[model samples]
Target: MSQELPTRLLLIRHGESEVTVKQIIGGDQSCTGLSVLGRQQAEALGRRWAEGHEPKVDALWSSTLPRAYQTAELLAASLGDLKVQMHPDLVERRPGQADGVSFSEFTDQFEWTGDVHPYVPLAPGGESQSDFFHRTGKALYELVHSNPGTTMMVVCHGGVIDVAMRVLLGLAPAAPFLLWTLNTSITEFLTTDKIGVWRLVRYNDSSHLSGLPTHTDYE
Candidate 1:
């Protein structure tokens, strides 16, 4: 009997973005792309890959957001200049009407009560927690099924990664825990022969950033 190979899923959070420095809600409409430090971070990861730090990736995917696309581009430049397949499903949680506003302003305008229902939208027209999870789950399921036994790299937002973790690990939706993934950090997962069997190989691995100046900001 031959053993089945596991499908490798490499999830990477986008580098720092302009919205992080400005402290604003960076929905698709408000995203202005990576900042100076963000470019450096992405480039560093690229260099690491270029130097054969990890196994060769078969495909590259990224969120359509500017920040994510930019990071993907930088990474592609180093990874044999691979093409980045953009997917809207990989974007961060939609902020809706609260899109380019400051956090304080969003609080004042939306009157968030610190806790919101899972089905309630984050903003007037934004996706609720439940909605975001559903979108992420569907996208991940499709990705895993579409490319079995291949190593795929996905550059997306932290929220998307969090939802992926939950879906893959069979955790409760909106579990009482938070995963603060750093910019450009890598999280890996492997799928087994058993249905719904996924193993978390690593999470938040940014070893390529040793001695490099880095900062974490709200997503």
Candidate 2:
């Protein structure tokens, strides 16, 4: 009998950015990076991950955006040996020219219902909610396939995280996830052929950042 493979995926949200504090859509935004506090948070997370002495990581992936890149860089730096790769597929929604717009402006300009449901298509002319679901979800599937039975860390955004949940868990596309993932927080999962069996052992874990900012800090 063959041993069942256990794949561990550490999904991390990028650190806070100026636009995050400003509450902008920030999708595909050309100009944005982590704030001073955000860098501190990422460093804290890197230290915790290093101290844990987790299994040798097979890969470190990040969204092409600079914020995601910055977070992954800190983590990889801590790992010392492992290398980081940039994947455009991991990028956040392309908010079109409407990027950096306030919530009010976003709602006013786009044909949105303010569904209060994140997975809903609130960003018109931008990638539809479903499109994002498939894009990020496909990237995850690809990563898992390559590393089968290995541990990896992926740095991305909240939207990608939500889409991944829907794809791997058979959840409704528009339903809200129970995750409150913060900058540098870890969400762990193991994926298998059976989507229903993909286990999320941890969700929105900030044990790596216990003394960091509160949830309300960015919200």
The candidate scoring highest on lDDT is 1
> Distance (Å) between predicted and true CA of 197, model 1?
0.8
Q: On residues 1-219, what C-alpha lDDT tens digit does candidate 1 reach at each position?
A: 112766889999999999998889999888999998899999999999989969789899999999999999999977788899999999998999999999888888999878879999978999999999999889988998888878899999999999998998999996899889999999999876647588899999999888877765554
lDDT of 1 at 83: 93
In order, candidate lDDTs are: 0.90, 0.75
Q: In model 2, what lDDT does residue 62 have?
A: 88
Give per-residue CA lDDT, model 2, range 97-154, as digits (tens). 6777886677677756656444555555667666777888889878876777777888
Clashes of each: 0, 0
Residue 218 deviation, candidate 2, in Å?
Answer: 7.4
TM-score of 1: 0.94
All-Cα superposition RMSD per candidate: 2.3, 3.2
Task: Give TM-scores for every candidate, taking all chains together and pairing residue i with residue i.
Answer: 0.94, 0.84
